[model samples]
Target: MFSADTEQWARDTFHHSELGDRRRSKRLVQLASSLANHLGQSLVQSLKSPADIEAAYRFTRNQAIDPQAIAEAGFAATVENTKHYECLLALEDTTSLEFSHSTVRGDMGHTTSNNYSRGMFAHSVLLFAPHEQHVVGLIEQERWTRNIKDYGKSQNHAKRPYLEKESYKCERASRAMETRLGEGMSKIISVCDREADLIEYLAYKTSNQQRFVVRSMQSRCILESEDKLYQYSASLTDAGMRTVQVRQKGGRKARRAVCEVRYAPITVKVPSNKKGEPVELYYVGCQEREQEKGLNWHILTSEPVRSKEEAERILDYYEKRWLIEEFHKAWKSGGTQVENLRMQSKENLERMVVILAFIAVRLHQLRYLGLNKEEAEKQSCEMILSPQSWKILWSKQEKRKPPKKAPSLYWAYINLGKLAGWYDSKRNGRVGWERLWEGWFILQTILEGYLLAKSLDL
Candidate 1:
C-alpha cells in the first residue's frame, strides 16, 4: 500500500494527466480503483448497485477521460522513474485487442490474422530497471484501428516510405521512448523481438546514439560475407556458455537451458531507398547446442559485443523482453480481460483500457519483486501498499490478527500465491503475473471494506 488511499494513489499517479474537470479526475481515479478491485467482473457486475452503475456510466460518458490523457499520465510517470536509474531497459512490442463477434465490430479494425477478426493494435514500450529486473513503468502506448482499405498497400511496402508501412510501429515506439526519456541517462537500451528488425529503426537508433537489442528475424546481407546474416553468424566461434532459465511454454518442461553464446561485429547493409551508409553493429547468437528444436536467439545490437560477458548481457536483455509479452497477458486475460467489455463507444473503451494498463503494470512489478527472496525481503509491503490494504491482506492470509510490523513484500506475494492456488512445492518455480493479480483482485475487496469502515468510524 502507498501513503494514501488506493484511489488517492491513482490520482497521484495520474497527477500530470488532464481530464478536463477536477471532479472528472476524481471520478476516474475512483472508477479505476473499483475496477482493479473487481478485475474478474464485468462493468455491471463490478458496479453491482444501481447508483454505482449509474456513476460509472456517467463517468464514462463525461467525454473528458480521453485515452491519450491516460497514456500521457503513464508516460510522465515513466519519465519520472527513469531519473532514478542511470541505465534502463525498455521492452517494445505490439498486441491486438480483438473484439471479434461483437456488434460494434465495424468500429474496431481488422486484425492481422483474419478479415473477420476485429480489434485495435496496441503498441507499447514497457520500461524496466535491469539491475533488479523490476518493471519501472510504461513509457508510451499507441493504439490505432487499422483501415481495411489500405491493408493492400502493405503488399507494395517497398515503394512506400518507411513511415507509411505497418512495420513502422517499431520505429514509432522507439522514437517515443527516446523523446520521453530525454537526455542525461548513461544508457537506455530498447529491447524488441523479431518483428522489430527494421533497417530504418536501426538507422534512427544509431543516428540518435540510442542503444538497442533487437532479435534478428531477417537473414540480411552482412558486409564482407558472401553468406547471409544467419549463415555468417553460424560460422562464428562459440564464445562461451550461459545457463538461462527458460519458462515452460507449448508443452515444454521448464528447465535451465545451457546456451552456446557467439558474438561478432557486423556492418548491416542499408536498403537502397533509405539512402543511409552501412550501419556498424554487433550480432550475438544464443542457442542450445543439441535439442530437437533448440532454443535460439539471434540478436542485433547498437552496443559493442567484443567479450563473452557483453554477449551474455545482450542475451540477458533480450530475455527480459519476454516480460512485456507477459505484461500483455496480464493486461488482457489475466487481469482486465479488456476484450470482454461490451461498451458501444470505442472512445470510452480505449480510455478504460488505458486505465487497466496501469493496473496491469503495478501487478507485474509487484509480482516480479517476489522473484529475489533476499531483495524482496528488504522491500516493505507498506511502501508499495496502503497500511489498511496490507493489514486486511495479512489478516486474511495469516488467519490471525495483523502484525505490528508490515510483512516483506515477498511474503505478501507468497500469501497471495497461495490464495490464487499456487503450490509452494511446484517445480515450475515462482507464480506468474496471472495468479499474482488474481489474488490481488480478492485483496482489493478487503482493502475497500477497510477504507469504508474507517470513513464511517463504526
Candidate 2:
C-alpha cells in the first residue's frame, strides 16, 4: 500500500493531480516528497535549500490549488490499491485541528467546548485490510469549520435539515467512497464509533446494502417486541465468554477482561417524528462478566452473527476502530505535527493539512509493521528502507561492515528503536510512533551525508 522510496511514492500519488496547471501538479509532487522524507519536521526544517522552502510556501499560497484536488489524488491512489484486498474495514472518525495562533485563529471557527479556541474539523475514512493487518490508505477526508455564531444552537439541531447538520459528514463520506470504489464497494465494511449511530446513517448503509458495524448510541425502539433495542439485546441468551485486551486510555491501566457475548437479529423502528421505514439489522452485545471497571459494547451491525465465532468477529471489527484515533494523534501531535503549522490563511493551512495527512498514514503504517513480530520477521528490510539506507543503518548500528544480503524487518525495527534511545526490555512497552520516526529521522540525516561523501568520492 505504501512504497519505500519517498520520491517515488510522492510521484505516484500526486503526479496526475489536476491542480489547474502542470507546474502546480509537479510542485505538489516535489513538496510531498520532501515532506515525506523529513517525516515530522516543519517546512523550514524539511526542505534542505532556501529555494525549496520558498517554493513550498508559494505553492500553498496559490489560490488555484484546491485542497480537495490535492486530497483526491491520494484517494484515487488508495482506491486503486483496494483492488488487491478481499475485505477491508473502513474506519471513520473526526478530529479537531486547533490553530490558536492570533494571526490564524480569526480565520478559523471555534473547536471543542472553548469558543475562544479556533480550528477546523477533519473527518477521515481510513481503509485497513483486516487479514493483512495493515492500513491501505485514506479514501476520504472532509475538512470543515463550524460557524462561531451558531455556538449555542444545540437545541435547534432537530429542526435543522439533515444536510445542514454536522453529522452528515459520515453519510457524505460513505457516498464518496461508494462512488470512488464503484464495483469494489462490496469489499468494504464500515466500522465507526458511537457518533455514527444515527438512524439516517444506518438506514442509508442498510438500504444501499453497505455492510457496517457501528457501536450503539441510542436505545432505539424495536418493531416486533415491546422492549427497546438495548432491553431486547439484554434479554437474549448469552452465547459465550471471551477475553479481550483493553488498551490504556486516560488514567486507565491496560488489562484483559472476560466479556459475556449476546447476539440477536432485531427490527429497529424509525423515530416517531422522522419519516423512515423500520430497519432490520443484527445486534451483538458484549459486557464484562466481572471487574469494577470493565468493557461493555452495544454493537449494531448489518452482518449476520448467528454463532459465537461470528459474534467474536463483530467484536474484533469494532476493536480495530481505535486505529483511527491513533491516526489522529499521529497526524496532529505525534508524527506530522499538523497543528503546529503556521500558515497565515485558512486556505494555506488546509492545503498543508491534506498533504501532511498522507504522511501521517505512512507513519502509522510504519509503526504497525514494526509492532507485528510475525509479519516483520517474514519480510525483508528492503520493503521499508532503500538499499543504501539499510546498509548504512546496519554498518552504523552493529559497528561492523554492511552485509551483502538484506536483513529481516524485525532486525531493522529493533535497531531503529535502539537508535532512538529505546531500551529493549520486556518490562518496557512496545516502541511508539514517535520513537520509530525519531530513529528514521536520524538515519535519513546520516544517509544524506553518506550520499554526499560518495558523490565527492573522497
Candidate 3:
C-alpha cells in the first residue's frame, strides 16, 4: 500500500535520530529516518557527520524504552529465533572489523578499523544460527586507547589471551540472551573456536550457566582428571559408544566410529602468554576419551558427559562454528563496511561498533524472515520479528552487490521489497508518463529494427 511507507518505517526503526550538531536542524532525523528510503538494499550513505548521528543516537536512546520492555522483548525474540534452530547455536569471536585511527601505539595498539586514517578500533561478535542460516546476534564494539593484541600465538600449552573489551561485549550479548533463556525457548548449544578459551567465557557460562557445546584448542585446554590436569590428550570414549573428532583438518568429516579412550574428568587449563610462564588452571566437569586418530574430544562441562552420543553431539555442535565464519565474510563486505569504518576519534569508533552491532541484529531479523517457509505463519515475541514485520524491517537490503560480512538474507528482503515497490532500474531520463511510454516504444522499435540496422550499425 503506497510503497509500504518506507520513510515512516525507517524513522520508527531507529528509536531516535540525534546527529550531534544537528540537534536544531530539522533534517537530521529525517535523513537518518530516510536510510530505508534510499536507493537500494545493499547500499546506503553512512551518516558521516557526528552532528547528524549524535541526534540519531539521542532519538533512539531517549525515546523512553522501558527496561522491562527490552527484557521482555529480549526473551521473546530469543524464543522466536531459536524455535527453528534447535540443534546448534554457533559462537563466533572474530575481528569482524578493525581500524586504527592512529599509527602510534597506545593501549589497544594498531586496530583493524575501516577509517584507520583516524584513531579508531573496530571489533565485533556474531551469533550464527545455523539451522535457519541467519545471524542470531551481530554485535559491534569499538575502543579508544587501544592495546589490541594478537595472542593467537601460544608459547606453552596453557596460555590463552582475551581482550578485556571483547570479554565485556560477549558478556553483554550473553546476558541479553540469558534474560530471555528458558522462557519457552528451545535449548541452545554454543560452539566457539580457539580464542574463546578465556576465563571470562568460563565465567560467562557459569553465570547464566546453561549447558553449551564447545571446542578445545591444541595447546590451551588442560584436561583435568582427579585434580591432575592432563595436556595433549586425543579423542574421548565412554557411555557404550565410540566416536571421533579430528580438528587438524582431516580430508573428510567421516563421522563413523574411529577410536576410543577410557575418558576421565579434568580441568582444562588455558595458558596465558602475558607477564609470565604458562599458568595451569582448571574448570570443573571436563572429561577426555578416545576417538579417531587426530580427533581430541576433551569434554569440558559442569557435569560429566553422559554418553558417547552426547559427546559426538557436542563436537557436532562445535562444527557449526564454520557457519559463523561464513557470516563474517558477508558482513564485512559491500555496503555494510562495518569493518572498513575509519574513525577520527576512538569514541566515534566505539559508537560505530555498537551501531553496527545493532544494524547486524536487524539484518539478521530480515534474513531469518526471508528464509522461513512459514515466515507468514510464525511470530516471534517482540524480540523476534515476524515475516510481516520483516517487510518493514527489511529496509536494509542492497541492490547491486552484497557487502563484506553482509548476509544474503538482506538480498531476500530487497527482492521482496522490489515486489512491494523498490525498483532496480533508474527512474530517470524521462520527463513524464508520455516520455516514459515513448521511450519504451522507441526501445521496442529499435530492437525490432536491430535485425538489419542494429547488425550493420549504419
Predicted structure with the largest lDDT when compared to the true one: 2
TM-score of 3: 0.48
What candidate 2 gets wrong by more than 4 Å, as runs, is 425-429
Candidate 1 per-residue lDDT over residues 396-421, each given as its tens digit: 77889988888887788687777778
lDDT rank, highest first? 2, 1, 3
The TM-score ranking, best first, is 2, 1, 3
lDDT (C-alpha) at residue 200 in model 1: 82
Estimate TM-scores for all models.
0.91, 0.97, 0.48
Better of 1 and 2 by lDDT: 2
Q: Alpha-carbon error at 68 in model 3, in Å?
A: 18
User: What residue runs in model 3 are displaced by over 4 Å at the alpha carbon?
Assistant: 1-90, 100-109, 112-134, 138-190, 218-304, 339-344, 361-458
Off by over 4 Å in 1: 1-5, 45-52, 150-154, 184-186, 272-274, 450-458
Q: Highest TM-score among the candidates is held by which one?
A: 2
Q: What is the lDDT of residue 383 in candidate 1?
A: 59
Cα displacement (angstroms), candidate 1, residue 434, comes to 4.0
Q: Report the C-alpha lDDT of model 3 over 1-458, residue by residue, as the tens digit.
A: 00234344333333243333334224432543343222212112434367756655543344342323322322243355455555536365555344433522232344344223223323343455554455555322223334345333233433333544444455555555555555422355545555555555655565454545544444454444333333334343334434434332238653444544334445544345433223232221133234334444444443344555545545555555654543443344422345555444334344434434333344334434544535423433222322333333333233343332323333443344343344546442112212222222232233335545757886
lDDT of each: 0.79, 0.89, 0.40
- How many backbone clashes can be found in candidate 3? 78
RMSD of 3: 13.1
